[model samples]
Target: MAKIENGRKSVDTRSIRTISSSHIDDESSLGSDSEINGFTSDRQTDKYGFIGGAQQYSEESAQDVPTEVLRQREVKWLDMLSHWDKWMVKRHNKVRLRCQKGIPPALRGRAWLYLSGGKVKREQNQGKFQELDSQAGDPKWLDVIEKDLHRQFPFHEMFVSRGGHGQQDLFRVLKAYTLYRPEEGYCQAQAPIAAVLLMHMPAEDAFWGLVQICEKYLPGYYSPGLEAIQLDGEILFALLRRVSPIAYRHLEKHKIDPILYMTEWFMCAFSRTLPWASVLRVWDMFLCDGVKIIFRVGLVLLKSMLGTREKLKACQGLYETMELLRAIDARYMQEGFLVREILELPVTAREVEREHHSQVKRWKKIRGELNFKSPPRMHGARFIMLAEPPRRQDLQQNPTIVVEASQPTPQLKKSKEEKSKKKKSVKKKQPIEEIPNPYPLLSDPPPPPKEPPAPPPVSSEMPQIPQQTLIDSPQQEHPPPTDLSLAKESPLQQSTQSLSSTEQDTYL
Candidate 1:
């Protein structure tokens, strides 16, 4: 028997009986059936549809943001969607602001697709998901995936039944990811992330969304060794020292590892930890702002729980600290309050990057060489140009070529001069002629034709005015093309045309 110190008490590890694999497998197989029969009825569910009594701290209780405000935000998001490329390129700050405010739930899934560049990835890799879905994935990974299927959101109505469509779709998504990335296979943490995506989008879209998360947004997070997360753990610790030194000192005193608490928090992106509403809000910012949001959230939680001496006094040892972190108070998880805290927190991407470099160097110095190799973390959405509104420069360069009727060119000037000379010379010789009118009105005859307005007195030499040319100007070698096809075409078509040949072939 091994004893571990727990502040004022000591606990025997041998007393913690570990369940056998057979027992765990048996429970896994019966999980859905047990949940369905035990408690998952329509009557017994929260507003969010979890098979439990209504939550004490609901989204409404967190902060009752007016419906009109959400509606207005929805409108702004719609506009952003239409001009996605422009927003991503030029007005990304606005995107960040809107994401921090919270993506309207109605638009959350679609916005996630755009924000994560999943839509573009899906468009680029058309039919790939179907191919992967059709094939049988590796048996090894499939078995592991199957065991975890019921474990993900078993209480939710979607996954309550044994082998329900939700579970089937979830399986397809996870299995497809295995085939798509055979080397990494699947991680248990991925199931909840994929489940969250499947709740909002189709299986294929969810698959691509998962791809973006794995490959881009949070690269190397689900790899075999989880080296990226380990590195981030160090980085998070370094940051915590600055953000909340009291919490830092408390953990240091207990000789606690950051991984013990933060693994699930970072790997699952807090889906399992935070309230459902706050989870969605965090995802909104995460997908929009990338992994920095995850770091900030972790720091905020640490600070909120153990920042002050009074809070740290309660967590006397590793056990108490772990317990406090695992079962965070519901008050701290409130959506509005949490989001406000996260946004106000001063953790920036630059700081995260700087810390990452420092930690990487320290690791290399200690370990001799790094073992894992993963792609660089993507900050936000992949920089794909979408159908965007015309830029001010583009509009300025090819302005509407309107030629005023009063502004005569040099060529027209000669003709006008000739006509004026003839009219003056013939003024005495040609009298107004009035033959019989074809349709005479009963009303008094119309007044005689007014004399033509006299031309302005002709100067001996015309003022040296520069010739104004509408088309084929001498100065312009090639006049701007007047196709306006881009302006006329829908945003989608423009986005398609804007794609490079490689991108078109790859995506389209």
Candidate 2:
């Protein structure tokens, strides 16, 4: 029973009246407005509104960035990697401190390799990345990564860019890594990891970082058994208890599990969850602190989840619970508020080792007892559906085409609401006028009727997605989700769903 402040119900019905008047006599904005709804209801690659085209993802000028930019990036990365030479441990230490603070924006690319020690390894070991990239066997990760891609960070601009070039590039880097590390081949988590890499470093450097995963570190993480992914979850849990106890107790009480959420964090190495702007910050610590930061971020996420423990336990399925742990604000969680909580985590090497061994044993034990379903498997498919090649325009802007449904929306009389999509500040989900033939549904209205002229066409500036094949296998699996952009809906709905990701005025 909400009461109106002005006894006369000070509601200004002017806008409403103006809207109906504008539409009844004209064919202005009705279709445009509804088009937006249709857009948001479908899955759009440009989830972050990075590029607003209904087109598929593609590149800008592939002619090249002048070998100079590539060379400069290459030489610079080599130098950065070389700095980790035998005589340069001090240089590595200094770089470590700089990373502790944060890698400078311009230096991020080079710093990435220097931080990962990838540069040194490549310099020290040639034919390694190629060897790993080409080393062949059945890739075990295709299925899991694909499923997670849709949910990993549905809100991030980079991953959600309506199957644009950026998204395709992400897939390429990770796919290459799988080829390079036959052991880790095509894991879902790698997409985000590569995402973080591609954002901060050049493709080559990022590629090497992927190699480094199998080179010295991460043997168990990507090991064949799904063994690494699961066992590490246990190891990470122990690590969290040692680092932050407050987050631990709360998690323990709620019986929350970090296994499901850790997939994204561990898989992408934080690229999937954190904002691109903030990834360098996380990367800085990751480089300087080693693998410990991964565990710390894990604990921090769990600790943050303590607040929603009860609600989390009640989740009907794994997906909802997964999103909750992801929603934890780490900045607030680790601001020294969990000092007491940190004390409760298991810290001793023996203690962790005992738990780790037991956990690993359980993975083995469960093999005979309960059947844990393996993640989805991706068998490369090329031309599984009606796929197309990239065009020049799509390269710069998204090019994904809508697979129109067989049933089209019913045609009705023109209305003012349709005009709203053309307006700059488009809002999604606004109720549409439902009247059936308000003005006239002309079967063959005056050629292209004047009383009801059509609205302006929808447009976008997003990059297009590129087609690719597996490194060694001839199987050409088309990226099912990457082929579509925001075109599936009207510009209005796409813009509205996009706006939710950012706090900005709808200049549309």
Candidate 3:
């Protein structure tokens, strides 16, 4: 009968739950008081209650430039925030460019919250997240969520240790998601992305921000099958071929798969792949621009690593190619320069639309042929291309058409099985020795044929005691099959002679 105030309305939190007797974990008592205070040590407590990270602000660590320049940018951002509604409508281009430059860490959280519509969503879905947090999550997804918490940002100060404030908050956020969107459940990628979000905002704000991201920015991405990620990889490859043909050719020649490098880049929204500074900058643009930022960032990294002829020549094999791509020069990945390159790239919304349509069709066709609803077995593993020629058609007129290779007919499989049976029957009649023995030195008999289940009286474990039965009950075990003609050909004639009888009866 607890009264909960949500926006203008007062509602009982207990009314949302089915069971009255269910025990709800006290959300407030999950973390230690010191760790709780530590999480908001960076931000002004009077201004932001419990929604920010423990990011310390020294004069030196404030910005990447002089205080004066940082102050000017901060002023512009403040003005923008003041007139956020009007500026978002009228000066979107200006807002986008400013975001590309990088949001100051002091104002970054608010900017991301505003850009991602977290604030509005929070107000609209008031107390919904708190209700979700109170419910116990599915054990299936909770275990997976627990496993991925430490794996999210192992080096980040907040998430560095297990059972810390950061880890506890991360667990609550992800667990709430599994309860909120039960169909989507908990995805491995969502953990790192949610951890990044929690670094900027409180659990409630982060939950809403994550909702906007999973639904608006990355729809159909973190579902059970992960169809969006696979389709995007195909689209990215197509864009790569158009944007940097030479680099594309080098990758194709080396068999460097898109899956190898692109999985974490797209799945975690580049949180795991890029440098910290660049990662924050990218996150800013990613929140504003949607998934295109992801494709552009991916293209930039690939083009930088493989774009140069000298770089391509230096990579001798798959391992070298992976190493070069994995280890991008930090100097080159500076936020200012990298964002500029990404913005300048020729990738467009219309082009992505075209590619998406084509790739989706291709995906459906392949799925139909292979009957593969889930991601491929080794979709995350890197594979070397063993010298396949790169296709160089202009994407404008002749987009790559992915025709699904027809599967082998059932008749063909049946014919093959019939042929194998005939071979075995022929081998069985060729009098054991006259036939060329595949294993001449080995005397083990062929394995028994698989048959339908028999009566329950026959024991399944009797096969292991074959030799003991032969010695113990020699007279009773079919009288050694009066085969005088075949007995002289082999030393183990009795055992070999009884092989057929043993297989025919289930008791044997």
TM-score of each: 0.69, 0.45, 0.61
Considering lDDT, where higher is better, how would the candidates rank from best to worst? 1, 3, 2
Query: Over the full model, what C-alpha lDDT does candidate 2 score relative to the true structure?
Result: 0.46
Q: Once superposed on the true structure, which residue ranges of model 2 sit more than 4 Å away at CA? A: 1-83, 86-88, 91-93, 121-172, 242-250, 305-324, 330-508
79-166 in candidate 2: lDDT tens per residue? 5444334213335454444454444455666656654555544555556555544543233444444444434343444444223334
The digit string of per-residue lDDT tens for model 1 on 429-454 reads: 65554332222222334444444332
Q: Which segments of candidate 1 are over 4 A away from where they belong?
A: 1-42, 54-56, 59-61, 382-508
Q: What overall lDDT goes with each candidate model?
A: 0.74, 0.46, 0.65
In model 1, what lDDT does residue 248 have?
Answer: 92
| Per-model C-alpha RMSD | 19.7, 33.0, 29.2
How high a TM-score does candidate 2 get?
0.45
Q: Per-residue lDDT tens digits of candidate 3, residues 1-508? A: 3232211121122211231322223322545322332333443331212223322222112226577878999999988877666566677789888887788777887788777766666665668988998888798887777777656655355664335557778888888889988978988889888988888877887887887787767776788777777778888999999889988988888887788878888889877665566778888888877677888998988888788888788888899988887777654566666888988998876687789878868876776532323322111001100111112220011113778889989999999999999999987876655422111112344344434222223245332224433332223212232223333344354455355345434434
Select the stronger candidate by lDDT from 2 and 3.
3
**Winner by lDDT:** 1
Candidate 3: clashing pairs of residues: 254-385, 255-385
